[model samples]
Target chain A: MKIIACYSNKGGVGKTASSANLAHLMAQSGHKVLLCDLDPQGASSFYFRLKPAKKLSEDSFFTDQDKLLKAIKGSDYENLDVLPANMDFRDFDIFLSRLAKGHSALKKALKGVKKDYDIVLLDCPPTISMLSESVFSCANWVLVPVIPSTLSERTLEQLLDFFTQHKLEKSKILAFFSMVQVSKKLHLDTMQRLGEQHADLLLNTYIPFSSHIERMGVNRAPATDFAKATPAAQHYLDLWRELATRI
Target chain B: MPRLWHSQGEGDFTPLLSWLENKAVQRGLVLSQTEFLSGPLALIDNGDCQIAEQGKSLLRLSHKLLSISQRDIYPLHRKDQPPFDFPLPPRELCERIEQPPAWLLGLAPLRNLQILARGKGRYQQWRLTNRLHKTCGIIYLLDIELNGISAQHFCFCQTYRGFTKSEKLLTSWQRYIKDVFPGQTAGVSEIVALYRRHPLVVHHANTSMQKGRPDIASQTKRWLKPLLLAAFSNEQGIILDIDTEYLHQYRVNMRKARSLLSLCKGAFEENQQQHCANQLANWMQNTNVLRDLDVHLQDQVTYQQILPPHLHCQADKLRHNLQKERQIAQQRLSDQLQSTAYQTNKQILMQSIAQLNDGDKGQKPATQYGRKRLIRQLNKIFVLTGQLHDQSPDDELHRLRIALKKARYLAEFFQRPKTTKRLSVLASSLKQLTQDFGLFNDACVQQQALHGWLDSARAIKRPPSENIEALTLLLRYYQEQKRQTKYKISQHLRLLNDPNHQSALLAATQNLI
Candidate 1:
């Protein structure tokens, strides 16, 4: 599976909306995309109109590590499969880390069936902790969503610096300018500077600042489908096309 | 109205009767100190008496309105009646049951039936009239055994089959002794008083392994231990006999795990040794430690008592195949190296080791299964030392010995059938390795069982050392006898590699398969 983790160390870069739309678009494009919401706020769960797991059994995710393909439950979409994490996955980190055989635990859990999914999107929680590190380890590619504010600019650099220090492959990480407001000269300047600093590192398509993206959260529907053929929807479609080609 | 008149002076009925005589003189139809059984209808020229269904009529009452006997009396469901009822079956009635059902052997209306709630513990039960389903019945009796309880609840289960709802018979002593035995109860001294007071308690037949004794071995025999009681519904119905293959599967898995560990270990070493470097030293150290522990455990405990034997029975099979296969593969590979063991006296030793290590690779599946079956058959020597204070029957043990001999004969060279088949030659190659181990392994089992018993007797709380010593001596003698016999077997094993003998052996193994 091509796991694309939508990450930014800072919050409010439209991470949730982007995750829902990207997964919806890929699913719409006849490719199976398992959009795993690692956020665990039940936001992704709400968007899909499903309840969180009632009981979070350790065995649910940690059965025979070699037999991962058997554990996946099929989603309503034909090829899409979900390994839904519980909201209390925050506590699960502590629970699993304390186990005797915990170091290769996630590696064992996700060892098989990488080829099964066309794309696996992890809507990572906005933090740099054990969970983020774990997701980064499993992710084949990391996509950073950034608002064109100065702090977003600083957050993006901080993330880049973190990856550089860790000695991770720069090719696997992609940064895209999101929430673009062309009316603001500051936003335009930041994007231009980001491009010059990281050549071929910035994605071509930028999501324009639109109230329609906000309506997606209120309407409790995917932004692409909710705002069909609108400028905002077109921007997302362009973004998906660009991202797909790069990947 | 069915009250006992207390005799004041005697603290019995005699003084109360004398007082009643004074009152009787004034009343012409005097019913003084008369027992009230069926009701106040005992006023027929009555005197002091105990009334019953079969009691003598002190005076025949003309007023039949109040009498209980000599009529088809119907039941009245009276609610809010006074706690003390006027009507009662007389305490010493001729028949315990008012109406005798034909199925009942005696006067009692109910018969005790036994049913087990299959899992680990008891739930609940009580007895009333078969139709009424009342809850006031006391636990008159509680008897426990290897099965489960013959309690107040089991009694109700017996009288009314569905009262406990789908109870079955207990299958094992472990489940029963672990639960249901009543000596584990808190305050249970007055057995006679409890039984006399309430009489519905009864025993479940075939419930105890040793009859008549309460089989109370386990600590938690509460009929409802805290652990399992809550999980069970009214009846603890098992889906299937999970304990069905409990012993067999454990044994089989353990052996497989051991074989895999050893084979992988040997393969790793062989791969390393092929380069002529000992990089496998650390791995060998870890393996040796585990092997030492396993050997110690095998020596310390009997097969029945300890964990399943994880000693790899498939070792000889692997070693033999590895040796034979390496030779041909080496012969093909080393044509460039130009070395021939067939040219020197070292040829025999090299050939012997090579034949034992790497031979069979792509043989037929039927031939493989045949080799396994023959191995299992030939390794079945389970003879006893025959020195126990309590002797075990020789039928099973003797049968094992015979099966091993038969399996060996079928694998040996001279005993093989003469025939012309290439498949037969490929087939008997496996039989050679199996017979070698099978012969040696049978000797080991006898020695282990016999020695383990003797060791435990001296150290543990065993019966005595006399039986153990006798058994030990017998096992030692058998070991010596087998030691001499092994010389002939080794010679026979050597002949298995000879082309002529091997050809004949293959024919016989093929026929045996």
Candidate 2:
């Protein structure tokens, strides 16, 4: 299973949109995928058309990986699966802390579940709390959709540096541009500069600004599905293509 | 010191001890001896055998020859259960694991009616039993059913077909007694045998013990319906998992007293294992040894490939290229050289390399197992698409994780060669791959949860979004977990691409067929 986390320290960078589209693209490619909406804001769940779970339900047993994996649920797409955020997930840290190996709560939960999916996407809240830390520890890659602004860049750097300075594993972090307004010279230059400076780190595809993307909320459809034929669709298609192959 | 005290006198002493006990009990005499176990049965001490306060009804003596108990054994202390738990029939009942024509000394007619009720209550279950077959003492099943209120007296015969209220039952029951024990004829003519040996054990059911509580009548009719239905099914009692015999008990046990469970580990198919050996498949996936194939897979479908497959999709191209590369590899190694000089000089090196590769000389490239067969087998055990499959990705991710586990187990079993010092380095790469796979597995689980939530909405009969907003907060939380997993899987996979990690990975994952 490949994990891609759409995370940003600051909200409103289209984190949910990016995650939702990537999930769609991954699933479109015949890969069994799971889109986990872990943001308390639940925007990703909304994008996926899932009613946020009121509670964790019985699958909370999944958090304890040492025991047998309790089966779970999925989405409308054939292979796309998701773990919708729940109110109980808010208190997850407490439950996780009570475990024998707290650091591996998510890791343990992930155990014995890979046979069902080819890729898993995580849409994280814009926070640097323990949940984010836990997410970082559990994910295969952290995909930050920077809006190509100096502020977004700073946050991205912090997220990257947090893992790097700790001497944490470096290979799982994949950063790319999201909501890029190419008409803006700054957006164009930043995209170019990011490619030049960290060509290896930046994803070749950048999510471009699309008015239709904002209206995806009104339509209650994922941007990838809503803009299937648009340039924005290509962005997700490219991201999934890149990620599906990499994983 | 002797775990088995009755291993004496060359011949089995079980029958002899049974004979002696029956002789003493016929006249209601208590036999008392203590010198030795079963040599000559020397009389070491004699008494009228007053029952100890603990076990008030039976004799209070110890002998190595017999599996006897102290008189202090309270009637209540002995659990009254379906007799199979005992592993042997009552000495007074005269049944055993090695006897023939056995009978389950039945409950009194009224209790018999309670335990076995309705329709086919006396079907195949009443068949005569050989002494060797297992049967609990003084126990019988009843079939019956009821509605409106929970019936006080329930019968189990509803689920069993082999039960019958036939005369053959009595004859078979008698033959069982006469077979294991020939000295005494179990006094015939009784419709249902009382547990004649024990002194009518009555335990305090909080006060005055409720002995012989089972009443055949005044029971629900529900038991009868199910019992009658089950009796016709013919599979009422035999364990359905016949593969239990082939399964070996692992020294390392988990879960419960029974090491094997129909869930988790047992495969649904008994005949398919040899056809496709995957007992160790999960172990192998955990190890992620096939990571080498990923690069090869990537290269074939790569945009740079000179010859693209007929399909225009990148995925198709990748698949085709991967196949082509494998074919090329096979061809390159297929040609045999004729030179004796080259043969002798390069044979050892080639042989060692071939052994390391387990390379098909020229036949075919080994296929990469893409987590499918394992999933297929598991699905057979429990449908991957059941309501249990969920409306989301949580279960799918979980299934993936299971495969990863099998991979890990496989890798551990086939560790890099210890003889070579590079083995340590190889182990390190294998560890890195493990982390990568672990991250991937997490991502799979996170996604499943989302998909499942949507399904949950339908299951609960609620329209989408009516409760959706309320559920969002929770779903987001799960998504965050998945997002994090993506990072880890990517990071770990990249780590494997590192040149430094490659040699080690190959070393540990070297095919050794």
Cα lDDT, model 2, residue A79: 59
Candidate 1 lDDT, B302-338, residue by residue in tens = 3222222332222233234434544453344223213
Q: What's the lDDT for residue A124 in model 2?
A: 83
Docking class of 1: incorrect
Least well predicted 10-residue stretch by lDDT in candidate 2 chain A: A64-73
Q: What is the TM-score of chain B in candidate 1?
A: 0.21
A67 Cα displacement, candidate 1 (Å): 12
Q: Which stretches of candidate 2 lie over 4 Å from their true place?
A: A57-72, A93-100, B1-513
Top model by TM-score, which number? 2
lDDT of 2 by residue, B346-373 (tens): 3442232223211121112111121222
Stretches of candidate 1 exceeding 4 Å from the true structure? A57-78, A81-83, A95-104, A112-116, B1-513
